[model samples]
Target: MPTKPPLIHVLHPGLFTTVQDLGRCGYQRFGVSVSGAMDPWALLVGNRLLGNPDRAAALEITLHGPELLFEQALTIALTGADLSPTTNGFAIPMWTVVAMQAGSRLQFGTRRQGARAYLTVAGGITGPMMLGSLSTHVRSGLGGLAGRAVKKWDQFCVGPAPRTAAQSIGRSLLERYRPRYTKSPTVRVMPGPQSDYFTDDAVQLLTSSSYRVTTESDRMGYRLEGAELPHRASAEIVSEAVCVGSLQVPSNRQPILLMADCQPTGGYAKLATMISADRSLAAQLAPGDSLSFRMISAQQASELFRSHHAELDRILPPCCS
Candidate 1:
C-alpha cells in the first residue's frame, strides 16, 4: 500500500499565510507574475536549516502567524519575523531547527518585528506545481494550496524528512545571516530603463527624500507617500516589461516600488530599481515604516549582488553549494 503523506493540521491561519518558493521564472512574456516569498532570504535560511533544496516550498507567514498541529514527526525551522513563536506553550527560539513530536501544538503571539516570516519543514511542503513553481500568485489565483492563504482546518501534506543524519546545534543560523527589520533602512537603487523620462530633480528627490510606506502597499508594490517626482516631459511611458524592485512613477507623482507580485508590464515612467542586495530589507518594511534611497552605479549594484550571494553561501555552506 502507498504510505500516507505526513500532515499539518492548521488550527488557525493568522493574518495572511501562504506557501511560497523562490518564484516562478521565465513566464513574464506570457503575463505571469513571479509571486513568492516576500522575504526570500528568510525562506532560504529555514530551508537550509532543514536541509531542503532552495526551491522547496515553505509557509510565508505575514503580519500574524498560524497555529498548527503536526500529525507526524517533523523537523522545522523559523526565520525572518519574530512573531513570538511557542511550541506546546514553550517559547521557541527563532533561527534554529527544532524537532517536533506528533500532536504538539505550535502557536505565535504578537509580532515582535518584521512584516513576514518563513516556516520550513523537513523536506518541504507538498503541493501542485504550476509553471515550474509552487508559489501562489493570489491575485491570479494560481499556484500554492488552492492559490490562497491557508485557512483554519486546512491539512497540508509534508514531504518526508531528509535521509541524512539530522543536524544538532549546527542547524542554528549564524547571527550575520539574520536580517534586522526594526530600523528604518536606506535602500540602494540603480537607474531604471526609463530614467531618462524623468527630470534630473525628480531623481534627486527620490534619493534625497524620505518616504513613508502607505497602507495601500501589498505584495504587489510599496506605495510611498512623499515628495512628488515631476516628469521632464510626460509621466506616461510605453508599457514595458518590469521586474521586482522597479520603481514606477505614475501621474499621481507618488512612486510605487513594484515587488514580488508586481505585474508583468506597466505604463508609468520608471524611475529607479532597487538593488538585489536590499530587496530582502524592502520586504520587511511594514505600513508606516519610513525608508530612503541611495543611488548606486550599475557596476556597484552588480558587485554587491555577487557579494550578497557569496554571503548567503558562506552563511549556509551546506545548502547553497
Candidate 2:
C-alpha cells in the first residue's frame, strides 16, 4: 500500500499567495488566460530540487509570503525571490532541498530580492485542476484554493510520493540554472504583429526609453510609465491574439507589458513582445522597478530561446522533466 500524503496548515495567508502549475494550454481560443507561475524558471527549479515533476503545482508567494505549519515531517524546497524564508525563526536557504520536522513553522519576512517566491514539496501541492492546469486566476476563479488565493487557516496537502523515490535531501541548485533578477532588468524583445502600425520614431522611443512599472499593474498586465510611443494614427486595432510579454502601446503612448492572466485577445497596437528568454526577468520585476527593451531579430530571439531552454533542461534529470 502507498504511504499517505502529509498536510500543511496555513497559519497566516500572505498577500496574494496562490497555487500555480505551468499553465492552461489550448483553451485560450475560448477566452482563457494562461495564468500560472510568473517566474516559471524559479518554480521549476524548486520542483526539480524536490524531485517533483516540472509542472507540479507549487505556491506562488507574491511580494509577501505566508506562515505555514507542517503537521508531519516533509521535505520541501524554496526558490525565486529571496523573501527571507524562515523556519521557527531561523533563516532557511533558497534553491535547495530542506527537510522540515513535524510541527515546524515556516515563515517569510522582508523580501531580499525579486517580486515572487515559490515553495515546492516532494509531491507538489495538491489542487483542483481546471482546463488541464491547477493555476489560479483570481478574476476568473478557475483553479487553485477554489479559484482564489490561499486564506488564513486554510489547509493543504501534497500528492502521494513514490515509495521508491530517493530522498533528495541537501540538494542545492547550481548558479548557472538560476536566473539573476534585479530592480532594473533589460529584456530582449521582437517586433510585434502590429509593428507596422507604429511610426519609426515610436519604435526608436520604445527601445531607447526606460519604463517604470506602475502600482496599477497586476497579474493581468503592467501599466508602464515611460517614453510615449506615438502611433502612426490611432492606437486601436482589431482585437487579436495576444500572449504574455506583449508590449502594447495605447493612445496614452506608455507601453503595457502583458503578463500572466492577460486577456487572450487585445485591441491595442503592440510594438513588441519580450522574448521568451527574458520573460523570467520581466516576471520578477515589481511595481516601481524600471526596465528597458533591446530589440532583437526574430532569428536571434529563436536562438536565445533554444539556448535558454537547454539551460532549463539541465536543471533536472531526464525522468524528472
Candidate 3:
C-alpha cells in the first residue's frame, strides 16, 4: 500500500487563512485578478526555509493565525509578522524551521507587526488551481480550496517529506534578509501617465502630505484618506490597465492603492504608481497607519527596483551548489 500523506485539521480559523502561491500571471487579458500572497517577501522566506521553489504555494495567515492539529510528523516554517507561534506549548522561531510530531497542536498568538504570515511545508501545498494559481481571491469567489478563507474542520494534505530534515537558519542570513517594518513607510512613486490630468497643487499634495490607511482596505485595494487631490480636467479617462501598485484616485478624491486582487482597468485618474520594489511595504501597512509617497523618475525607480532584488538575491542560498 502507498504511504498515507500527513493531514492538518483546522481547529480555529484565525482571522483569515488563504492558500497562495506567487500569483496568477498571463491571464489578466481575460480579466482575471493576479491574487497571491500579500507579502511576497514573507512567502519567499517561508519557501526558502523548506527548500521549496520560491514561488511554491503556502498558507497565508492574516492578522491572527489558526490553531491546527497534525496527523503526522512534518517540517514547516512560518514567516511574516511576529505571531508568537508555538507547537505543543514550545515556542517556535520565525524565519526558521520546526518539526511537528503527530497529534501535536500548533497555534499562533497575536500579531506584533504587519498583518499576514506565510506557512510553508517541504513539498508545497498541493491544491486545485483557477486560472493557473492556487491563490484565493475571496471577493471574486475564485481560486483557493473553495474560493474563500479556510474554515474550521477544513483539512489539508501534505506531501512526503524531503530527504533532508529541517534545520536552523543561520543568524547572519536572518540579520541580512528581513524586510524593515516601519510605522510610517515612505513608498517610492513614479508619476503616472494621467498625472497631467491633476492640478499642480493636487500633485504636490500627493507627494507632500501623509495619508492614513482606511479600515475599508482589503486584498483588492487599500483606500487612503488624506489630502484630497483636485483634477484639472474633471473629465473621465478611458479605463486602462492597472497593476499591483497603481494609485487610482476616484471621483471622491480618495486614493486607492491597487493591490494583489485589484481589477485590470479603472476610470479613476492615476496620480502615481508605487514602485514594484516598495510594494511589499504597502502590504504591511495596517489600517490607520500613516504613509507618504516620494516621487522618483521612472528610470531611477527601475534601478532601485533592480538593486532591491539584487540585495535579496545575495542573502538567498544558492539553489544548486
* Alpha-carbon local distance difference test for all models: 0.87, 0.87, 0.82
lDDT of 2: 0.87
> Candidate 1 lDDT (Cα, whole model)?
0.87
Candidate 3 per-residue C-alpha lDDT over 1-321 given as tens digits, one digit per residue, 9 for 90 to 100 = 998878889999998899998899998888888889888878877776677777678888877899999888878888877677899789887777777788999899877777777888877787787888888888878777888999999988876655554553322236556777775899999988789888888778988999998999988899999999888877268887888899988888889999888987888889899998888788877788879999999999989888977876777652331
Candidate with the larger lDDT of 2 and 3: 2
Candidate 2 TM-score over all chains jointly: 0.96
**Model 3 stretches astray by more than 4 angstroms:** 165-173, 318-321
Q: CA shift at 125, candidate 1, in angstroms? A: 0.5
Q: What is the lDDT of residue 167 in candidate 1?
A: 60
Residue pairs with backbone overlap in model 3 = none
RMSD of each: 1.5, 1.5, 2.0
Candidate 2 lDDT by residue in tens digits, 83-169: 999999889988988889999999999878898999988888997789899999999989898898999999888986534234678
TM-score of 3: 0.94
TM-score of each: 0.96, 0.96, 0.94
1 or 3, greater by TM-score = 1
lDDT of 1 at 233: 84
